[model samples]
Target: MTKRELIDNIARDGLVERLVANVCHRRHRSLPDLVQMVYEVLLNYDEEKLMRIHRRGAINFFIVRIIENLYFSRTSPYYRQIRRFAQHSDILKDE
Candidate 1:
């Protein structure tokens, strides 16, 4: 499907809001940024993979997996280290 169609369907069905609400209730972070991140991931989807998902009719499963993976990655040590590195760089830049 095209980007416009994917976005339209997501918006019309409130998929992003539902996903964000599900996450925010448990993880108190930037809701808008998280939601944007999800969409950004979706926007960068590989067409072949998307087509395979469409063929399998497991779109919801795919989306939930993506979100769960993103959440788990955020809680991982590697993610924390990367975040800290970014923050350290930002602090250095400020000085």
Candidate 2:
């Protein structure tokens, strides 16, 4: 299937439905967009890493951070090409 079709499938899968909703609530983004994030990260990271973080039953948790870091976070290359994804994690000051 195409990426779009896979994303749609991810969104519709009942097991992930609420977890996807929770991620959307936390990140203030859309569901398919969140699924897209998972798709991208899945490309770069290994399935073992993803499964380790997301697990078979709860991938949405990982999807939230993936999307947040990839799109909204300002510190990493996710936001600008200036910083590397590994070396920059300057999110701080609230705690």
- Among these predictions, the greatest TM-score belongs to 1
lDDT of 2: 0.52
- Candidates in order have lDDT scores of 0.66, 0.52
Candidate 1 lDDT: 0.66
Per-residue lDDT value at 12 in model 2:
72
Q: Write candidate 2's Cα lDDT for 8-84 as tens digits.
A: 56657743445555544644334555455456665666656555554454556566566656555676444464223
Q: Which candidate has the top score in lDDT? A: 1
Return the lDDT, model 1, position 91: 91
> lDDT per residue, candidate 1, 1-95, as tens digits?
77558667887898876876775464443455555667777778986777678668887767767666655576744346444455577799999
